[model samples]
Target: MKFLEENLLDHLQRPEFAELHSVLINHKFSKGSYICQPGMGSNQVFIVVSGRVRVYLGCEEKEFNLGILTKGDIYSTHTGTFVQALTDAVVLMTDVKTFRQRMVGDPEVTKAMVRVLGNILKTSFTIIDGLAFKDVNSRLVALLSNEARRHGMSLEDGSVQIQIDLSVEQIARLVGSTRQTVSMLLSDLVRAGLIERPERGKFLIPNLSALESVGGVTLS
Candidate 1:
C-alpha cells in the first residue's frame, strides 16, 4: 500500500537527512511479533519501511485498535499502547534522543511533528465518533469508504475498485464488531449492488454515493 507519498525523511528534505540512513537500523519482525508493549523501556521511534503493524489497547481477548500503520507510518516506541506486527515487516529504528537532537533547532521539524500529531488526533476522534454514535453497519461503511478513498482506483464508470486483503476477523476487529455480523453485512452490501466481490478478497464499489448513503454520510 502507498501509505506515504512523502515520509519523515522527505519531510526534512535537507542534506542532514542523509545522516538518518546511517542511524536508521533496519529490523525485521515476523507476523504476531510484539514490537513494543505498554510501560516497556522504549527509547526509540519506528518508521515502517514495509508491511503493517497495529497499535492498540487491551489484551489478546479484546483489543481496541487505535490505528493500523502500514508503509511510511510512524509510531513512538514509548506510547502507552501495545504494538504488534500484523504482517511480516521491516522497520527503520532510530534512537529517540538522536532523532530529537537532529531536530533541536529546526522550525520545519516542529511543523512536521505537529502535522503528524494532528493526524493521529484526528484519527482518534473518528474512532471515538464511530464507537459512541454510529452503529455497526455505519461504522463498517465508514471504514471501507476511508480505505477506498486512500487506496482505491477510480474507474471511468464512476466505480472504485479497492484491493482489500484483510480477513473477516481482521475487518471485524477494525470496526469493533463481531466476525459473523461483519460477514452478514458484507453479504448484504453485495446483494444491494453497493459492493461486489470480484475475487476472494478484493471489492469493487459500484457507486460511491450508494456507499455514502448506507453509511449515513452527507457530503456538502
Candidate 2:
C-alpha cells in the first residue's frame, strides 16, 4: 500500500544512496515463515521487495495485527512485533548500524525514515482507537475503506473495485475481531448494496462514498 512517505529506494539512482543499496542483502522467506519474533533482539532494517508480511503482536492464544507490509514497504526489526510472511517473499535488509550510518550522510534517507516512522505511529493510534471506541462492524468497515483507498481501482461507473486477496480469517485478525463476525459483516455489506463479491478475494463498491459513510470513522 502507498503511504505518504517517499520510499527509501526512490533515491537508489543517486550516488549518495549507492552505499546503502550496496549493503542490502537479499533474503527469501517462505509463506508462513516468521521473519522476526518478539524478543528476538534483531537489529536489521528490512525493505520488502516482493510478497506480503503481517506485522502483529501478542501470543499464540491471541494476537492483534498492526498492519500488512507489501512490496516497497520498509520496516525495522527493533520493534517487538512479530513479522510473518503471508506469502513467499523476498526482502532486502541491512544491519541497523549500517542503515543509521548511511542516513547520517543522506538527508533524503533521513526524511524517508522519519516519514515511515510517522506512518507507523499513525497506524498504531488508529488501531488503538478502533479497539477502545469502535465496535466490530465499524472496525471492519474502516479496514475495508482503508484498503479500498489504498489498493482500489476506479471504474467507469464511479464504482471502486478492490482486489484484496485476504481471507475472512485474515480480515478478522486485521480488525481484531472473530472470523464469524467478519463473515457476517461481509454478508451484511453485500446485502446492503455497499459491496459486491464478484469473485473470491475481490470486492466491488457500488458507491465509494456511501461505503465510507457506513464506517463512521475518518480514514487516514
Candidate 3:
C-alpha cells in the first residue's frame, strides 16, 4: 500500500486497522476547496494522502495562515478551524471515534500520536512567535530560511537554492502580510544581495548570513 511505502500509516498498521480499511472514506478536493470550516462538525480526522492543505484563521477578507501540511500529515480539531486544499488533494477521512478505537490495541500508534502532538506543539509556538514578535520582513526571511533548510539544493558556491513556486499572494498570506508589502520587502532583500530569483519560480540565497541579517534571524 502507498501508506506503507510512505510510512504514513506506520503506527496504525497493526491488525487493528484492517477493520478500518473497509470504512475509510477517500475523497479528492480541487485546489482552493475547503476541507472543513469553522462551525463544521469536529468529529472527523483527515489524513492527507497527496497534495497540500492550508490551516488558517480569519474571514475571507483577511487570513492568518497557521501552517501548510502535505502528504502524510494529519489534522483534526475539537473546535474546527478553516482548512482548505492548497492543491488538488487526496485525503482519507474517518470519524474521531473510529480513529480512537483503532488506537486501543497498538502501542506504536500511541507513540505516533505523541510524536505528532509534539510537532504540533512546536509548530504552534513557532507560529505564535512569528506573529507576536517578528516583523513582516523577518517573518518572510524565516519562512525562506525554513524552506532552505527543508528543501534547498546546495550549490558549489556555498549558496542554497529553494524551488518554492509560491506566488507573492500566497507568501503574503503565509506571513500575515499583504502582497504589496511582501513584494516591497522582497525587492529590498534583492537589493541587499540577500535573495535572488534565479529563475521564474525559484529563490536563491547567495549569502545565508546576509539573508539572516536582513531578516534578523539565524537559522540553526
User: Tens digits of per-residue lDDT for model 3 on 1-220?
Assistant: 0111134555345565777544568989998898899887667877777886777676566665555666776677553468888679998888889888755765655565465556556656786898899899899998888767654789999999986556888788878899999999998888888899877558999987778877888654
Candidate 3 wrong stretches, greater than 4 Å: 1-6, 10-16, 77-79, 151-166, 198-202, 206-210, 218-220
TM-score, cand. 1 vs. native: 0.83
Q: Between prediction 1 and prediction 3, which has the larger lDDT?
A: 1
In the range 17-102, model 2's lDDT, one tens digit per residue, is 78778888999999889889988988999888888787777755556666677777788888888889878999999999987876
lDDT of each prediction vs. the true structure? 0.76, 0.80, 0.73
Stretches of candidate 2 off by over 4 Å are none
TM-score each candidate: 0.83, 0.88, 0.78
Give lDDT: candidate 2, residue 130: 89
RMSD for each of the candidates:
2.9, 2.1, 4.1
Candidate 3: lDDT of 25? 80
Candidate 1 vs 2: which has more TM-score: 2
Tens-digit per-residue lDDT, 14-86, candidate 1: 6766665567789999988989998889888778888778776765665566666777677678867788887
Q: TM-score winner among the candidates?
A: 2
lDDT: worst 10-residue window of model 2 = 1-10
Greater TM-score among 2 and 3 belongs to: 2
